[model samples]
Target: MTKPLISTERVQSSTGPMVIASVLNSPSERTSAPHRHARGQLLGARRGLLTVAAADHHWVVPATHAVWIPPDCVHGLRSHGPFHGWSVYVAAPACVDLPGQPCIIAISGLLREAVDRAATWGEGPMDQRQERIAQLLLDEIAVLPAEPLGLPLPLDPRLRRISQALADDLADNRSLAEWAQWAGLSGRTLARRFVSETGFSFSQWRQRARLLRALELLAADVPVTTIALQLGYDNVSAFIAMFRRALGVTPGRYFIAAS
Candidate 1:
């Protein structure tokens, strides 16, 4: 499938304008290898889901959210299906006041509209009106609230082994003790190091992994019952409850609102 027209080398040049915006439309799935740009980027999907991975952080960006990638951050992108979105690239100097790390931020209506308007501009220096719109976009990004759609990965090799296993098989219901033994670490060490490394207990991290997976499956139009079963949930109600607790809305309602 064809990828979005974002070039790291082109966007990162110091001589480029302060902000560069582009609209993305893909009829099928697309994937970009891990890469870095000297320019920071704000990427959001308007009609589908995007999975963005940067360093040890992974974010599931729905239509209502955007992922901010700081300048020179190594990252990759994978679209869940057809994708229609926008990307705004900022010069390195202009990113000094923006987010210092990769995160998923809630996209406000004003920011969305501003980006849409900016995406239509032709190449070259911006006019006074365009400059004002660009500033507005930057202002909105600086203050937008971050959403809890990111999963932090652990740094320890043993912990990564366990984490990767869980990600590969969300239905794995191994207890902390079982996982510790499997990884050749003591249960206490596993629990403590999990919190220290990923800022989440083992169980909490697994739940978050499941939540993120559910979102990917949902974007592909998976049935709720099937998703619950696939994620090892005993019933659909339990899965829905967990999703609602994390996102403050049921799965159906969340996607409905996003659409």
Candidate 2:
């Protein structure tokens, strides 16, 4: 069973150009509200999923990915099932090379272990060996790529209503015309407005909303075929193709990487 949100003050209060690992077990809870840290944070789940949202963007994190949240970024996390994760915090000035904007970053083996080990350290400057590892971690992060894996929310109420409906059920394969009717606008007007406000056409945005829900189900060990059908895919292969296109790998491979 999950417990209440874990207190993060220990990691929050640490000093220096430091890296502190905060571990989370499976079936975890959520932060009390939107909050910020003075230092940058890399939030990753090694064994489960974490839903993180900030600045109108939301990411559903399977174990394969982590999010880079810049210093003072207001964000929050929610976990529904089991997971083993870490919150790796780095002091501000030192986090310069890392992204200032929130991003979804794929984690490599060395970086993951570095964070796992850092969880055991104290608040002072690292020893030579520790310093070496810290440098390597930063070097890896500097070159690491970011994934466009988040679903962005729109400020417009019409778009917001559609987003909410899709969040409740990703299987709604509504077309532009259908959505426009619901929004009380014509199809052409709705299409243009959606792209202008959300940077995604109605179809693209709906697909991402669906994919985000699929990710949560996938992390829970739900079968891919079932997820495909549940999300309104024509068949398993089609869903796999879409998943690969969005994630650069097939669903099975993606979940394996997460594991």
**Which structure among the candidates has the greatest TM-score?**
2
Runs in model 1 deviating more than 4 A are: 1-4, 7-9, 153-236, 247-259
lDDT for each residue of candidate 2 in 1-77, tens digit (9 for 90 to 100)? 23322245643554664666567665534443677767777887765446677656665565667888888788877
- TM-score of each model, in listed order: 0.67, 0.70
Model 1 vs. true fold: TM: 0.67
| Reference-based lDDT, residue 126, model 1 | 89
lDDT string for model 1 (36-69, tens) is 8888899978755576788778655556678999
Q: Candidate 1: lDDT over CA atoms?
A: 0.82
Supply candidate 2's per-residue lDDT for 216.
58
TM-score of 2: 0.70
Worst 10 residues of 2 by lDDT: 1-10
State how far residue 245 of model 1 sits from its true place (Å): 3.1
